[model samples]
Target chain A: MTSSKILPAMPLLAAGLVATPALAASVTITIPQVKVAEYHRPYVAGWLEPVGGGSARTVFVWYDVKKGGREPGTKWLADLRSWWRKGGNTMKLPANGVSGATRAPGSYTVPIPANLPAGQYVFKVEAARETGGRELVSVPFSVPAKGGSASGKTELGTITIR
Target chain B: MRFRTVLIAAAAASSALATPAMAHRQWLLPSTTTLAGTSEYVTVDAAVSNDLFYPDHVALDPAAVKVWAPDGSEGKVENPSKGRYRGTFDVAIDKPGTWKIGMERSMIGGTFKLNGEQWRVGGRRPPMAPGAARPSGAAPAGAAPAGAAPARAPGAPGSAGGQAGGQPMRMVASVAEIPAGATEVKLTESLSTYAIYVSADAPTKGVLTPTGKGLEFDPVTHPDALVSDEEAQFRFLVDGKPAAGVKVTLVPGGKKYREAEHAQELTTGADGMVRVKWPVAGMYWMSATTEDAKPSDKRASARRMTFGSTLEVVAP
Candidate 1:
C-alpha cells in the first residue's frame, strides 16, 4: 500500500477528484428536524438545471400524491410553490421513480442516472410544509464527460459523483 | 380548561395543522404546466382571497409577481387584471421547458383574532397571521380598522400583562416577544405553494439528479420510458438510504383528475420501492411526503418533507 514511487501521483489524483464519479454522481440530502410547536409533512422536490442549457433532470418529488380531490385538496400543492413552478405540479401520477409519497425525516440518496451528460449543473432541493415554511437549497457541481465528483451544503449534503 | 393550555399546547405541538389552522388559500392556476415549444404563451390565474365558495377574485400586486424561465431568466407580469377573489396575468415562454411563475416569497399578514375579534391577553398581543393582512412593505399598524382597531402596539418584549378574562383588544407582538400567559391566540403564518409542469417538446434529461436534500425520490427507471399501461417501479431515498413505509400517491392526469374519487395510494416496501400501473394516456402527477415528530431545533416548526412530479403517458 505504501509505494513511495507513486506517492507523487496522489496529488494528481486529488486534483482529478472533481472530474470523477460521472456515472456515480449521487447525492444524499438530509432534512434536519426543527423543534417547532406545529409540524406537518412538507412538499418536497429536487431537480438538476443545466449550467447554460434550458433543460432540467428531475431527481424526485415526494408529496401527498393521492390526497387531492376537485375541492379543497388539490390546493395543498401550493404549499411548495417554488417546486410547483419548476415542474413539481406537472408530476401528478406515479411513473416509478420521478414521483412518490413523502418520506420521514432522514438522509435520502438521489442516484444520478448512470447515463448523465457532462457539464456544469446545479443540484437543487426545495421543501415546504402546510403550516411549516419553505426552504430551497442548491449546490453547483461539474460533470466531466467521463467522470466527476463534488459536494454540496445548506439543505443539501454529501453529494457524490461516481 | 383555562384556554391558555390549549394555546400553549398547540404552540408546543406546532405540527398539529399543516398551516395556520384555517387560511384562505391564495393560489396560482396555470393554463398549462408545459409548453409545446419556445416562444409559447401561458396564462395564470392568481388571487389573494377567500374564494373557497365565492366566485369573486382579488388582484395580487403585479409587482409582487415574477415569471422564471427554464434558464432562470426573470419576467415581469403583463396584461395584469383583477376580479372578485382572483387576479390574472399572461406570459410568453421565452425558453423551452417548464417555467415557474408565482408570487414572491413576501409575507402577507393580519392581526390575530382572539375570541372572534382582534384582541390581546395577559402581557401579550395576538399572533399576526400572514397572507390575510396588508401586502408586503405596507404599514402593519393601520391594518386594523378604526372602530375595531387595536388599543396597543406590538414589537417589544416584557410588555404589561393583563389579568384573566381581559377585554379583547387589537394588539400585536414583535418578533422578539412571546406572550406570557396567552389564554387564546391563533398561531399565525400560512404558506400556499402551487406547482404544475407541461411537456415542452418532450421532457429532456440532464444532470437533474438528487443533491441529497432532507428527503428525496428518484426514478430508478428511465423517467422518459414511463408510458401508458406499463408497470413502473420507484424507489424512495431518505437521507440517502432506502426509505420504507413511506406513503406514495398517484393520481390520473386531466383537468378534472383532481375530482377523480379513485386515485391510487400506496406505501414503499421495506426496500423503499413501489410498483404502479401507469395510465394508458394523458399526463399524471405523483406526490409523497414524510415528517419527523421530533424537531431538531427551536427555530423550526416541524421537519416536514414533500415531493411531487409529472409524466406523460401515450394513448393505448
Candidate 2:
C-alpha cells in the first residue's frame, strides 16, 4: 500500500523538474507572378522590422550588378527606396549578406531564423523597376510561446508564411 | 649724332610698315567632349576670336589646317566659313589614345604662326569612389587586406582592387566615332579581353585591334557599320502605355573598341541599352520584346513589357 502511494507522488515530482525550452519557428514568402520589361530586370528586397518604425534589418537582396564583367555601383541600391532606407542603407559591405543575381519571373523562398525572439514581427517586401516606380508589400505575423504560427496574404498579391 | 639719327629713322620706318597683322584664332570643339559609349559627328570648332574680327568678315582656309591622327591617316577641315569657322568631320578612332589635332594657321597676308598643345583624346574619365567594386577578369596589382577576401572572378561585380584601405581604381572605356566603311576595330581596355558584336550588316572580315586604352575594328565594308546617321526607333510599355525614344550612337565602334556593342536607345523608360552581337556582316532586323503571356484582375498580375526597334545592318 505504501509503495503505491509513493509512485503516485513520484509522477508529480517529475513534472515539476521538467524544463521547457523555447521552440523554433519559420516563415516563407512567395510571389505568384511578376512582369518585367526588356533590357530590364526586377530588383527585390525583403527584410524584418519592429512593430513600430525605425531601421529594419535586411533579409535578402537580388539584382544583376555586372553587365559583361563589371560591377554596377552600390549607389544604385538607393533606387529600391523602401528597403534601402529601412535595411540596405545601414549595411557596410553588402556583397554577402544582401546581394544576389537578378531574379526572373518566378517564386522565391526565404526561411526565418528559429532563434528569433518570440513576439510580434513584420515582413516587408519592395520591388522596384530599373526605369520607373516601385511596389511595396508587407505581412504581419506573431510567434507564440509554444511556437505557434500565424499567416496573412495581401491583395496586391499572395504571400504564404508559416 | 648721325648714327643715332639713322637708327631712329630706321626704327620709325619699320613701325610704319608693320600693319597690325591679321592672325586668326581657331578652336576645336568635339561634338561631345565626354561620351559614355558610341559617338558620331566630331565638331571641330574652328573659331576666330570675336575680338579680332567680325563674324562675317573672318574666313578660314580649309587647306590651311590639317588634322593628323596618331595613326598615319589624316583629314582636312570641311565647309570653312568666316569668323566662326566650324569643321564637321566624321571620325572613327578605334583605340583610346592621345589624338593630336594640331592646327597650323597658314595666313595668306600675315606671317603669324600658332601651334596648339596636343589635345589628349580618348582618355577615360576618372572612376567614381575608390570604395566602389572593380571588375574581375584581370587582377590589378597588390594583395587584399588582413581580413578582406580574395578578389572574385572576372565579371563578378563589386570586387575591390588595390592595397588594404586604398582607393580602388575603376576601369572605364573611352569611346570615339568612326566614319562608315573604315575597316579595323580596336580594343581600349588595358590587359583585358572584350567580346565584339557588330550589327547584323557589319562585315565579318572586320578585325579588332587592341591598343593602350581601348580596341578598334578595321576594314569595315558596310556603309552603316560605323556611322549612325539615320535615327532608329525603340518602343516599350511603361505602366501599360506605349513609349519610345530616338536612338543615338554615343560612342562609335571604331574608338575604344570593346568586343561588345554599347548603343543606347533613349526611350521613355530607363536608358534602353540592348546588347546584340554582330556575327557575319549582313542586313538583318533586331528588336527587343517584353510581354506577359498571362493577365489577372489584380494590378500586380499585369506584366510590364519592353521592346526594341528593328535595326538595319548594311554589310561593308
Highest lDDT scorer? 1
lDDT of 2 at A26: 34
- lDDT (10s digit) by residue, model 2, range B75-120: 4444554333333343443322223333321001111111211111
Query: Highest TM-score, which number?
Result: 1
Instruction: Give lDDT tens digits, candidate 1, residues B196-295.
Output: 3333433443322445544566666544445465677878676677778767766553434244434578898888888878644555555555554423
TM agreement with the true structure for every prediction: 0.39, 0.27
Alpha-carbon local distance difference test for all models: 0.50, 0.35
* Interface root-mean-square deviation, each candidate: 12.5, 17.5
TM-score computed on alpha carbons, candidate 1? 0.39
Off by over 4 Å in 2: A1-25, A31-39, A52-55, A65-73, A95-97, A145-156, B1-316
Docking level of model 1: incorrect
